[model samples]
Target: MSSASAQPANEPDNVFRDPAFRHFWFARLCTTIGYQILTVAVGWQMYALTNDAFMLGMVGLVQFLPSIVLLLMSGHVADRFDRRIIVRTCQMVEALIAVAMAVASFSGWITSEYIFLFVALLGGTRAFETPTLQALLPSVVTPRQLPRAVALASSATQAAIIIGPALGGFAYVAGPGVVYTISAVLFSIAALMVFTLKLRQAPQRLTAPVSVKTLFAGFAYIRSNPVLLGAISLDLFAVLLGGATALLPIYAKDILHTGPWGLGLLRSSPAIGALVTALWLARNPLNRRVGRVMFGAVAIFGVATMVFGISTWLPLSMAALVVLGASDMISVVVRSTLVQLDTPDDMRGRVGAVNSVFIGASNQLGEFESGVTAALLGPVGAVLLGGFGTLCVVAAWMKLFPMLTNRDQLHDHSAHGSGKAATAR
Candidate 1:
């Protein structure tokens, strides 16, 4: 699956022109939709079962725990193994989990306790699949088209996020079993699409022997590069502080006084905003002042979160979420471009794993934090506090990581032998 070998003779400028990327993109969309649906159904079911914010938080925590424990090993494996095989296997496992859950739901055997166990399984699959998929992306398209490819991928994900929850909400009218079954079918289709991809995975990196240092190479690489460290940390803390997703269920039920369908709409609003932004970026890619834009977008995200937190009007809250998503999309595109372009081919898997961990922590762990805070200070107070905290983070990040703030171009960095070079590796 070498790029040279897989590249079509008549390739066009657009990433969508690449057949391999088309299949990969479709695969990603299906899987993302399945995961989003599963998330909504599970979250709603957990809340209904226990009526406890903490338990809903626990759902996120359980899924994230496995990734934390296996983070280093997963990166190592992604670097060493055939990433396609790894991804395909994980998708199969996820499909099985979905099927099992569907059967359990139909049989009235599904419970909050078993759901935790199932979610843990999902987490384990994610631990390996995320890095492998991240590393695999570059293999699908040429380096010149990487930015557009990333944008397209982001758009696909946002589209799935927009559709999945709404579909899940409607499906729920029948039963959770139906939602789970649909998810399983989508996962199966995603797996098949992955199987069809023609990627040229890089040869496994074997420069160093297996050791603690080698296992944790991704962390070391990120830590040594102030720019990369700041970029990653900014996203880590900003999203952790600003994330309002975990509280959405509470908002849908208590605050907005909406039913399951309304909950679906609430969840989908951010994705709608994000999808539009992604499409815009795909056409007009960022070329300058990348760092400043990222910071500005994050600020906007925080403000939107605060607005959503206080608004009693459903339309206002939804609109705020739309802005939040749009702002976050800018940050995502900038950060992802910085990360992928900065790292060498050999280290993409490891660094990608580290990035995935940061993302999972910001999202999953943030959910847990929201739940705990909600229990203590009520959902409204918790969201408002998070929004304020996000603004403070932006101020701190600008000062602490002057290199990031000073960066002007996304693809102009020379990978310093250490990781801070002003040009791509």
Candidate 2:
């Protein structure tokens, strides 16, 4: 068995016992909630200033573009630097950006253009921050603890999705400036918490040479590993095809005959389901038959999406969404644990960057895809097709990546190489 399969030895079972992991978790929580709040505040402010629906779309585009444009560089930087410091530095930068936004907003000098520029900067910092933070996790807790750690960490994000926007909405009553101020304070706390962390890392990772080969090394390494490629791409395609979230506003309004309050429940349902499921997994993990479970979970996700699509009743729609979210959480935990434990620590950053790209692309593109499809096919038709398409993706993945389909345990197959050896290929 590989070290990834290493059961708890002397280390405690509760991940929070390790003060390092505890700090890491809190930092994750703070940043996730802070970012969520900031996102709501910024979008609201931009719309308030311009009163243009088109500008709202640009806000997302400006934020998302940086992650794609800087993917290769960000990955390499994560592998070459002190990841803890990288994470802390990025958070601090975000805090300053938030503060600047608050000042500009309160001063009544902020423009939609300025807001776009600020978010673009925020996106760039996050491009560095996300992958470095992912790579930093295994160092925070022992290998045996990583599965639980990922689950717990996921729970934090889900909880934040529920908490942040609602809090931001309430704060927006005071004005977007108040929301920005709150986010800045949260980002500062996250940075300080990250600063307090002490990682038990492997040997110092050497800086890879800055060449075309090194720049694309993460992409190359993932391609060479079929299991890794399968897991990551499965997530990409599943979310791409099946995400009905973009059509939720339509579903709430046109199909369900509901208003803003109904839309809120529809949106909250998935996050609530995901949070509960993540907490459950944190307490009781699924180590055995991981690949099969992942496939089943995704299949459930597809089914739930279809159920949500066809349902006319509000309660049924929300229930399907809850199932959709819980199932996706299971797949995410499995995929995240597999990706982290299977990759070499030296290459984790670069690989994580690629993973982030896929994730970001899936989300942004998924919403776009849903919109295009909805326009062509009615919203119900669009969602149903997405659900069915997700199922097709699952079937295709199982056939194309039998190694992934046949995987027995989450932690059993890892035998990673050094960065030098990995890059040499």
Winner by TM-score = 2
* lDDT string, candidate 2, 323-424, tens digits: 999999999999998888888777888899999999999999999999999999999899999999999999999999898898887666343444336655
**Regions of model 2 farther than 4 Å from truth:** 1-12, 417-425
Model 1 lDDT per residue over 1-425, tens place: 58556865444356787788999999899999999999989998889888997898688778889988989989888877778899989999999999999999899978999999999999999898888888888888766677778888899999997788879988989999999999999989989999999974454353666888778878888887777888899999988888798799889999999887788778888988999999888778887888889999999999999999998888998999999999999999888878877776667778899999999778876776888888999999999999999999999999998888988887764653446341122
Candidate 2's displacement at residue 314, Å, is: 0.6
Residue 95 of model 2 has an lDDT of: 94
